[model samples]
Target: MIISKPNINKSRINICRENSQSLEDIQNQSSSSQNQTPIIDLTKAPELNYKYGRTSEIATLKQWILENHTRLITIYGLSGIGKTALTLKLISEITTQFDYIIYRSLDNLPKLITVKNELKQFLCQSLSKPLPEILDYFKSSRCLVIMDDLENIFQFGNFAGQYLTEYKDYSKFFQQIANSYHQSCVILISWEKPADIETLQSENQHTKTLHLQGLGEDAKAIFQEKDLKDDEKWEELITLYQGHPGWLNIITLAIKELFNGQVYQCLIDEDEVFLGDIEALLENHLERLSELEYHVINWLAR
Candidate 1:
């Protein structure tokens, strides 16, 4: 018996070759042709009861990330000055542009290496991937990583931006994110600029820093929200609280309860704003002051 090879056209031969591939390989090829579903993890984000008045800051942040593809950014401000609120607002606006959005808070003081490993696992499906591989993955997909309360990694009572020794890896991680070729960006929200970040970062390198200030005229919204009376004294009340949303919220509560929502009367009746929980917030800031700062406070007290 003579076995003869069947005639096969080039197109049929190609189809036969494609059919020889394993199911897993075929599945991978099909999946690679399709865009991955975006992974958004914002569980750590804080819920805001009041609408933020950070219009300009939010606009600038959007421009930096979406328009410029800025890789590293720092948003520094006094505690309770609306840094977190502004960041959350910005994230909400730009979430559609990224393939993955992750928000992490350093407030609990997690190790930087631990954070890096977790981020790696989240991005690459395995924490064992090398840094270069992870960065390549970032290049292929847009990721937005937000680290809030970065000051938690710093040592207090020293110069500004001094990272705790154990957390130094964070600086290196940020440097890589800034200098390497990646399509992702990281936003750090802190009380002061991190020391290494301030040293190596430059605006031309897709690295930007924003120093957030009081809301100024925007503070009026807070007053309006609380329905406090005395529209004429709104500026005075805002100035007294230094336009700090946290402080203004505290004062509004006081005026609502003690003066029947009469803001002007509250101001006239009390020479000084009753701090309530604001005192604790101020004390936390005071504890981070340097020796000369303490001396100035002592001299002023005298």
Candidate 2:
């Protein structure tokens, strides 16, 4: 009897598909309770509602997520800089592109959320029908998991500049996930970037870090619609707001008073809090740096 070698490409293809299915099934058996949305659904909260701005950041993130080689990326920036909104927007737009997509906002994670435990919960939920342990699940499946503000859980060391973190334990887990999992991706969104984790990260050619900036023209349109006018006020308002949607929302409230909801109000109301808050806000969020950093930012702003 002649024993013929099996076809090389066909055999390899079958093996790949089988391995993929096995990994995917790990989180398919999720418990009923874990099926519900996490509390940080920014879309529903008034305080967390989506606003126009950060278009470039959203586009960058969406493109990065679609990359076959990129298994992870960070959408990092200062607080109230539209990171969460950009993240949610990207997730909503790209759900169909992934085998599995789950978003867990690390807005207020418990202090006890260790790397292992967090991974376990996510794996459990991702594997809804007969959820298995996280480690075994990632073995074969391709999944997209986003943990917003992961820096909160991580502790910092030498790598962190000002925003030090100690989430080194999570760093190792992420490396393992990326190396072993064939189609797994993770995104960490945070107010401050952690250098410790960045150091421990693999030298992947595909990993990306997107730092968000304020909005441009599109954001002005969003604000204009709210105040109900199309005039020079739109341009003036955009300049004042600097294209941060959250800030624009506050500005919108002020404009409503002057325009009486009849038109866009270019003039700052004498009694308005918006004008008062801008300077202080700039000092608070934008001036956390040393004197040199402040100078640099000011120079760049100008």
- C-alpha lDDT of all candidate models, in order: 0.74, 0.53
- Identify the leading candidate in terms of TM-score: 1
List the candidates' TM-scores in order: 0.81, 0.63
The reply for model 1, stretches above 4 Å from the true place, is 1-36, 125-133, 269-273, 300-302
How displaced is residue 153 in candidate 2, in Å?
4.3
TM-score attained by model 1:
0.81
**Model 1: per-residue Cα lDDT over 58-172, one tens digit each:** 8899989988999999999889888887876675565556666777899899987678777776676423555555577678778888999999989888778888989888887
lDDT by residue for model 2 (127-207), tens: 457445554654445456777766555433222223323434566555565565456677878766655446544566456
44, model 1: CA deviation in Å?
1.8
Q: How does candidate 2 fare on TM-score?
A: 0.63
